[model samples]
Target: MKYQDLKAGIRSHLEDAAEDFFMVGYFLRQISENALFTEDGYKSIWEFAKGEYGLSTSSASRFMAINARFSIDGGEHMAEKYIGMGVSKLQEMLGLPDEELEKVTQETTVREIRAMKKRQEAPRSFYGFPKTERPEGSLLTTPGCGDGKYDCFSCCRECAIRQEPRHCRTAPLGNPFPCTRVNNEEWKKNIAYSLYKDECQLLHPELAPVREGDKEPDPCCLNCTNKTCFNRCDVAKKKDEDEKKQSQEELRKQQREAEAKRPEPSDRDIKAFYDWAGIKTTDNITAEDLKKRYKNAGGGGGRGAALQDYTGSARGIRINHKKELTWVQIAKRIKEIQEAEKKKADFVERSNGAQKNVRDLIKQQEEKRRIEAEEKKAARAAAKLQAEAEEPGKPEIIDGDFREVEDEPMDDPAQEAAKTRDERQEPEPVLCDTCEHEGECAGKKTHENGCMGYEEKAQELEAEAEPNPEEYARFDVESILKKEKGYLDGGREADCPAKFIKEHKILVDALTLLLEKMDAEGGAED
Candidate 1:
């Protein structure tokens, strides 16, 4: 077959096989072992996984490793040993040989397998030595085999730990190799030293450096629980002393900065302090003196003390209090203050509500009194109008018909008597009776005067007469009494005795009738 046809067919088969994890692992093993993708211009399996198959390098590598361990001689089908096992279980058991893994059951978990493996890999002796040689693909890398002569070069120059000598790990843990300097020249000078001391002393103590007096010295400082050698080692002791001195210097520097930032005491604070000490002073006291007095009195000794003392004295008061706040305590204090403010606000609101209620009640009572007063006034007015309407002899129709006419001067008795008889007798129709101004004036000579023009007077009399049942019921009793008195005192003005006698007889009859009615009503009541 042509190379292109073969390649296409293989790609097609790979696409199908890559669907499952184990199948993909099988394909990966085949592709990597034969370097099949190299012909397609891919450099390695990682390139093939990324460029062609679209798989991550980590995922592809993991599949390939699993295929090698789970399959029989890297076969297409997974071995019966771990067919139903989880991927993680298989990864953990990968260190075991195929024969040993085949004995494991599907019921076994990954954690149990890992624990079993850890136990198997544990040191068998009490000297903390590994049960086996280091694994081929270990993560740990000990440069120059922990030799002190190894040159750190550019890597160490940029290292923060190297810049700060206090951060060096060897100061506390101690060096592993015989060479004491920054380089491993002492181990290189003796070829046997390099070969023997290649491993950590804790694991293989036979290769450790020899001491003068002790038959068997400690392999590593970390293994020594007593730590008695910390004082004996000159390097550890000197580093410890340097660290303590540096820490003290740093503490002093911080204190100096804080003291510089501290504010000067105010005038009130100065006066209060002087007063408390029973010393007469004023606001002119120097800041230096105040600070001295504050410090002597234990100022800045603890939190919240820079502003005031514990005894509620305002002596050492400062602008800012040196108090450290924790969130829990701040929240608790804030809640307490909020509750107090809420209580105060509620009290004010309730007081205002009560006042408003009282004002509203008073307003309602005043309105009620006003309404009652208005009702009473209206009732009294209505009663007075009713009494006026019921009064007898009250004028209803005053169209001037009942008014006395003005008399003309009369020296002759016969002419006066004729005029009086005409006036006192029944009304006579005038020759100009049809005149529009007729009856406007009460005088009999209205015709001769062409009728006085009194239109408004006529209208008022008509309006007043319209509301009553008896519009013309007025007796004009006062005019009749005046007439009688005039007749008794100066005789008749016109000498009409019959008319005067008739009026006297009418008055006597009316009084007798009124008396009889009153007597009858009184008897009925009794």
Candidate 2:
């Protein structure tokens, strides 16, 4: 047939099929799935047909094609090249009650879909080809509330509200992010607050910060079909979850790297920790005590030790002897061994205990620290008074004319606090700590990034509270140019939102990771 004639037939078929709603949807979905012209584009096959070939992909048929359609040509399918096989059959084969389908189709409640299934066997009397009986030993196939009646009007999805998949927390047995509406129910936007507050959640991967209560947007509460709308929303809850997980993983990795780089514990902290454990020094502690200290220090398990080399975990009991002992038996043995050890150690410790009561010793140490702290405070006060007395007479060492700090203004408390915090946060950069230059750590040949003379740099910093106008302007221009390159004024089309993007990314990443582990990264999808 000519393309124009074919298009007419399809459009006519669709118009005629409107009387039968099932056929209309069947036509729409088939056209949607298989009819697009380009491999990648928003246009559907039906849309492509209308545009490119001047063809129409819609259908008008004498039969609803709800279950099965027989063709006159033997072993022949419908005239059009067939790509999809099960859709029509699957719909007809579905044994869901009319009431249930109606509820699912129009009301948007997906709870009923949970128990009902698409792949399972149909009831014996369901109207379809090659009907089979329910299993002989089956418990029951009781119909849900008002499940028997099926009306043609409310069967198609267009008659009802639109719900995005991410809007509802509950998805059906195998499906993700389906509607949570009910059957023949009044279409109230808000039901029980619980429906939204607890049940409806977004599906994004943004990091959610720790908060005392629900920190998600309250405005998200009222307007919902409870449809999953992760794709459209910028700040989906799932995206927050994903971001947090990613940030946590990054933090863990960064911490691992940092810990690897970190210098070993200082002598003071190590000694303090050992003392707190009631050990004289870390070197004096036993392997078991070391294990305890490691646990307290937030360490976990590793290999190379024998299975029994380690002490019993916090929740386990030690076995004094090599035997198959029950937990109770092990506990009893441990207690007995511990009591014996205590008795043996007591003899030596009791003599030492009299010489210096542990508590009294600690108290004496604390008192000495307090006295030292008071002395330091008094010395600081005396020095401040002397500095004030000498302030008037001395020729200032700080050269006022070559001021590194601004001469115009004194500091604001708020600004000073902010500056102090910023200073604390900045990672120390690679700079030469030593320089012989006079004015600043400037234009000099040195091994360390020419950043030597930090003391000179410090002096310059003290002088220059306000930057030179021309210098600041030049720096600002470069920063703005770099930012412009990173993004378009508007966002990119392909740059899927992090939330929906994360959903797809996580799924694809999981698939890739799984494939790699399975040694099937290059293999075809199953």
Candidate 3:
């Protein structure tokens, strides 16, 4: 058939299918709404459709939704304009607005319609404010009210009224409007009061009372007359200023007490302390250097005594003394501590050296004793050998006959000859060297005797010496090409014979080239 005719026929069939889908959706809607499935001995429309027409639950739901969205004349018929569009395109267009539906045409694809719908429904800026900053219950976008107004404040008030049924604390029992009374203390304690105060400050800034020193009206100022008046108010402002001044004075008093309790040393005090302590000063004298000097002095005292002195009349030396000492007294204490530590360190060092000397003396004595024991053992062995060498043959009674048994010396010629022969012979190979049971084998006797593992290893070595038939079969180019050619010939009746033959020939050529490259590589290796 000609291509245009074929395309026309397919298009017509697609339009007919679209019409059938719409009618199906309309009929399913009617059946579901009326519970007409009960007449067919089914509990629900889903069961009836599944049993009679093989429609699944999800498919039935989609059909019902489509009918509800695109049906005309109370779902008696579908809109004729959507008949040519496929079911998938119509379903994608369902999310689009009524006005946007006009943009869809016969050429519009399902994916394009889906994208358009997504763009339309994408979340907008929350009422011209960031989503995080938007108030709870506030509309995401501006919505028209019954009176054709788009004021957010009014809408928020209405939303608040609907969500919270409580009346204001000062309002009459049945009053529906919000309480406008502003109390600064209440603003801190009550959420509704704070929100109302903020709303008034933001929306009606002109009505806020101004203070004397403020260049512009303070939006954060407390309201006194229910946001109705804008008179200059200074009583609250004056009281707040006085409280602030009092707090500052109290803070300064605390700082002074702390300073008096823990005073910092001046430059003169530091110099005097260092001089009395007999410590040299430099531009870069770190705490670490001081610590090293203290260690070298062998200082032995608690930290409190090293850094402080007692001024109490009852004490020659006080434990846990506070900072009652002057700089000179502190330096004197530090010098005494350093001298005591130095003496202690010196005594400890001398004691350690004496202990080391004693240990060395003990080690030398043990070595002398050990040498004497070894020498005695060697002398005894030599005496035994000499006695054996001097001894003659002794007669022994054996089996009713007198026999002579000769004693062998440590340096016997016969034993020496046997040792020489052993040294001259080459070592035997380990029986388990090539055995599979190597580590677990009993011994050389087991390996040499009737071990099946040894036999198997020998056989494996022999097999390795010969070429593998399976390996040759795997790389046999002629056999592989013949098998592939047979497959191509067999499939020729199912597909175009010429096309099959061409593809088979191309595969054969690729295989041949691969084999030739492999042969070249092998030859280079050889």
Off by over 4 Å in 1: 1-19, 97-103, 121-526
Instruction: Supply the global lDDT for candidate 3.
Output: 0.51
lDDT of 3 by residue, 119-223 (tens): 763332212211123357866543332222332222222231122222332345465544232223343344344434333542333334443443333343344
Clashes of each: 4, 36, 4
lDDT for model 1, please: 0.49
For residue 502, model 3's alpha carbon misses the true position, in angstroms, by: 99
Q: Who is ahead in lDDT, 1 or 3?
A: 3
Question: lDDT of each structure?
Answer: 0.49, 0.38, 0.51
Question: How displaced is residue 407 in candidate 2, in Å?
Answer: 99
Give the clashing residue pairs of candidate 1, or none. 148-183, 149-183, 149-184, 150-184
Give the top-scoring candidate (lDDT). Answer: 3
**Ten contiguous residues minimizing lDDT sum, candidate 3:** 310-319
Off by over 4 Å in 2: 1-40, 43-138, 142-179, 182-243, 246-248, 251-526
